[model samples]
Target chain A: MSDTKRPLSPHLQVYSWSLEMALSIFHRATGVALGGGALLITWWIIAIATGPDAYDQFRTVMSSITGKVFLFAFTFSLMLHMCNGIRHLFWDMGKGFDLGDSRRSSKMVLFFSVFLTALSWVIGYGMILEV
Target chain B: MSLRSPLGKVRGLGSAKNGTHHWWMQKVSAVALVPLTIWFVSSIVQMTRADYEVVINWMNSPIVAVLMLLFVTTGIYHLKLGLQVIIEDYIHSEGSKVFLQMLVTFSCVAVGTTAGFSILKIAL
Candidate 1:
């Protein structure tokens, strides 16, 4: 490998962001995040197998504020990816091909993911209502 | 493979043959993951307030264990396929692409094995 940098493609400044673009990018981004999230699942299972003490330690880490934040992020990513995956399935079936419809679906995914994530947390914490 | 030369056939290879299979499996696995993911997230959300024993007891169920093992396997497989596409597209270095591909495959196997084993151990 030679120590030389080749010319880069026109990117950062050339492309403007749109909902379609954002959804496409976030689909991949969240997909990547969810990949890393698998390790956390793995860790939890391993802790269970080890014994009660290890499981409690796992719970402690998971119950921390930082862990809660990360968990929320993971849940949000999962929801986003899921919504987009459904959109892709529709696309596969030759639906939602138009720009207007695609954008609409993208907006729907955004709103639905946020709503579902919030609802999940509400249920998890047993918070029926909060002002 | 269709209408290939005798030598090409003899070499047991030619242009990419399994692209369709790869694409199909990704789609199938993606579909499989939808319900599995819903089940998984709901379970985790419920476990947030449950004690360790409760969580273990939940995992100890035959239905839960088998489904979870299926979910982890399918999810990890899907994850590897998605990342492989991204890596193949963006990573310019041939060496890096091959290395990342191997790493992803290895990690998927290791993760699936450990997670499956643990779930089985607890359930059985």
Candidate 2:
């Protein structure tokens, strides 16, 4: 007789996931990942303040394979979070509520985040080449 | 012994009167971060190849320093708010939720203050 007693609806097995759903999960996941980036950036800035030796050690860690992977993931996460954030802003303005528009925007967010990540890395290496 | 009207209690329990302050500021910070992030990512990436003197010189630029300051300050604030919402939603224990809220604040303050000071030390 109670709504609370009813079996939970839309369990994972029951629901066919959508891009919007996946992106929603990624939004929060990336939020958490970027939190770690904050820590890394803080150490980096402090190292710069401490001068060359500290920064040299910092760069050593950054150039390591694990560090490279982390940096790549962190940058990708930042782009993804920013892209989804723009989608949310649009939602706030009372636009893109329709199913078709929501689907289109979610796909666009995925595309742009990946594109931006690749672009950043491309120019990033270009900077390295100039040195 | 209840003296309050039904409507008063109903309205009182909801809407802390701040209205959409959190929602609006999250968007504002998000908007600010778009350009800031672009500059920062590109700058830091470039600095990777440069020597310490060059890096310091880059940070020494007035425009670079100011943007870095804005980016870190607003970025951390936005992060704190976002984490609070996540923790509030997923952390079922009240104790953990409050603890996390404090953790987020303390870390952001430590990071933001240290970073801002670092930029200032270089720029000034």
Candidate 3:
């Protein structure tokens, strides 16, 4: 039996992706991820307000190795979202629409996001070790 | 001179007018989030080893509490509007777009109010 359904155009596997496309996809993906992380932050705040037992449970989970990994990812996502978000704000203002500017800003976002993420982790680790 | 109607005079308005205010608000909130997010991250880092009372005390400060509320509320509002535009542009289905937009708005309000009320309860 022959299939009647038509194949979709421009599937991910078919096209060679560019840095701009990769960054754009990652920007949305990270945004959704960080939105979930925001909920986790809200839960932590609520737990702190509840009692010691609640706070302890939250702290226990968040302090785990897995939690640290996730938090690191969250930090990176946060930074990427922040940097890309600024790029978006510039676009909204009708700036940075030129081809060179777009590519330059995209590269800047990628570089700064990594730098900020590393900086955050260093500062976070220092605080943890000191305290 | 009288061939055309007066309604044509005021017809075709200038801008769409809807996006201007929302765009302005989003920028305002984005600027606010700069300091707010930095302070938030610092506060969370400091609370790494803090106990329940310490956490409560920090949030209970009127200034901190107000800032937290502002941060959460404005952040959600900005996110909601941004996500709405993204959905409108990308989501082809009208019903799905409306549903998603409504969901985004409701979630923002719910999250913002819940977080604000919880903070207020602890602080006051």
Better of 1 and 2 by lDDT: 1
Candidate 1 residue pairs in backbone clash: none
Q: Give RMSD to native, each candidate.
A: 5.4, 3.2, 6.6
Task: Name model 2 segments beyond 4 Å from true.
Answer: A1-13, A126-131, B1-17
- State every prediction's TM-score relative to the real structure: 0.88, 0.88, 0.79
Please provide TM-scores computed only on chain A for all of the candidate models, following their numbering: 0.85, 0.88, 0.82
Ten contiguous residues with the weakest lDDT in model 2 chain A: A122-131
Which of the two, 1 or 3, has more lDDT? 1
Docking class of 2: medium
lDDT tens per residue, model 2, A16-130: 8888889999999999899899888878878888899998999899989898899899989999998998899889899998999999999899999998888777767553444
**Error of model 2, residue A117, in angstroms:** 0.7
C-alpha lDDT of candidate 3 relative to the true structure = 0.79
- Highest lDDT among the candidates is held by which one? 1
lDDT of 2 by residue, B22-120 (tens): 778888889999888878887787666677788877778999889989988988998988998888888998888888889888988988998899989
